[model samples]
Target: MFMSKNEPVSSPEALLQQIDTDRPLPPLEQWNPDFCGDIPMRITRDGRWFYQGGEIRRPAMVKMFSRILWKEGDRYFLKTPVEKVGIEVEDVPFQVISVERTGASPECLSFTTSTGEQVVAGKVHPIRVELDPLTGEPSPYLLIRYGMEGRLQRNVFYQLAEWAESHRINGRQVWTVSSEGVQFNLGEG
Candidate 1:
């Protein structure tokens, strides 16, 4: 059943702790909560959260909500043990806000999302680039967790390009990077 506006929601602070990124996430996959209708919350392409036409300026609140975020098919929702609330997503739910190269023996690219989720690019968390057919513009993404992906910011993409090495794969020239002994194609050359 869809919950109406008059149906009161619990306080955000009561839902979870704030600013503790290391906290473990809820087992949303195992939850079979009932739909509580859509909320005014929307996650922007650049990683901004908005509610009721106003931006949710608190990073902690955003992070807290992100912990319970669940994606099913093409829709996204904030799921709890008891209920689920639909939300809007402009692009992806997250943005790869920053990235850094780490490890000396087998150097890896470590990515940090706006919500403070850190993911290392490798076989488990692969990096993929998609090109728009009409514009031919590149959009790079990193698989975050549980089928969630974070779009790489323009600057992060440029950084990867700078470190990318040229290689020939399947008879085509391409830019690649190696992490955990796995070669990932950055783009066609």
Candidate 2:
């Protein structure tokens, strides 16, 4: 059965592919931390990058320049320009996080970067659909700003987890913590 709008999509792989592949990814150093709200960051003793915004940083690995896409209601939202050591060749892959109700416009969360950073072009909003209470008919379609901030946070966690897994960095046990108190332990490969 198809998941509801409030539910997250099953596979992130398709979401990853939906990214604007033609558009060049931004350099890691050029990623603006402010792109996804205020993500607390710290330099690891080993020189690895760490996101200190939420408690998840204590256990899970965070990365830079990745993309995550999520679906909330009917709309779609994307978080990009993740900050990590080595994720992309030219530019970092942004996360396509959540798709909220349609017709809603959400603000873009901002963060600081190591050096030069690129500004995101255009605004991404969620899709919305209204159903009849009695007939269960879809109508009154309109997008609404849903959990934009929350989605961005989740995107960051997922990107880092994916990166860790790709390099065989014991990512399976990674835990994704969000400011909204959402936590998940990523499976190991």
Candidate 3:
């Protein structure tokens, strides 16, 4: 069952502390909870959470769900210690809402997500652009964690473009961005 807003998810720090991410994830990979059936829950391509034909409309509730979301194989689920259930996700599970410059040894960019995750684009969280074959529209994604990705909102992608640098890699012109002292090639464009 989906956790309600009344649950103890008062802050993102509180949930991050529970995960203690400095350590490996809690045995979510090993334990297979009984499938509790699907719920009318979905994450839209624009990062809106919908339940029972209505928008969730609560940031805290969305952030809480982001913490518990788990992906196994090609399916996505919200898992707790005791149970798990499937949910639909259009495109990716998160949307990058903003980006800002951050101070680092050689400067870096910080991308903030709708769920309040700050992913620094570089080595671990590399950035990539995928063009839709039908529309030729470019979609940018940043690897968030554990096989999940955050798609950048249109405006945020423009913000990132301002900071991008063009470089020649392997005799081809490529665009790149640096964060966490690492450079991620955004592909030749």
Best by TM-score: 1
Tens digits of per-residue lDDT for model 1, 1-189: 225346765777666553255767777789998888898889988889998889989888888889888998889998877788999999889899888988997898899998888889999999999999999899999988778889999999998899999987789999988776777888897
Q: Find the 10 residues in a row with the least total lDDT in model 1.
A: 1-10
Of the two candidates 1 and 2, the one with more favorable lDDT, higher being better, is 1
Error of 2 at 114 (Å): 7.6
Query: What is the alpha-carbon lDDT of model 1 when measured against the actual structure?
Result: 0.85
TM-score of each: 0.90, 0.17, 0.80
Candidate 2 lDDT tens digits, 121-154: 1233322223457976432111112232221223
Residue 170's lDDT within candidate 3 is 79
Which of the predicted structures, 1 or 3, would earn the higher lDDT when compared with the native? 1
Q: What is the C-alpha RMSD of each candidate to the true structure, in Å?
A: 2.6, 21.9, 5.6
True-vs-predicted CA distance for residue 8, candidate 2, Å: 5.5
User: What's the TM for model 3?
Assistant: 0.80
Which pairs clash in the backbone of model 3?
none
Candidate 3, residue 173: Cα displacement in angstroms equals 2.3
Model 2 residue 79 lDDT score: 40
Report clash pairs, candidate 1: none
Query: What is the RMSD, in Å, between candidate 1 and the native fold over all Cα?
Result: 2.6
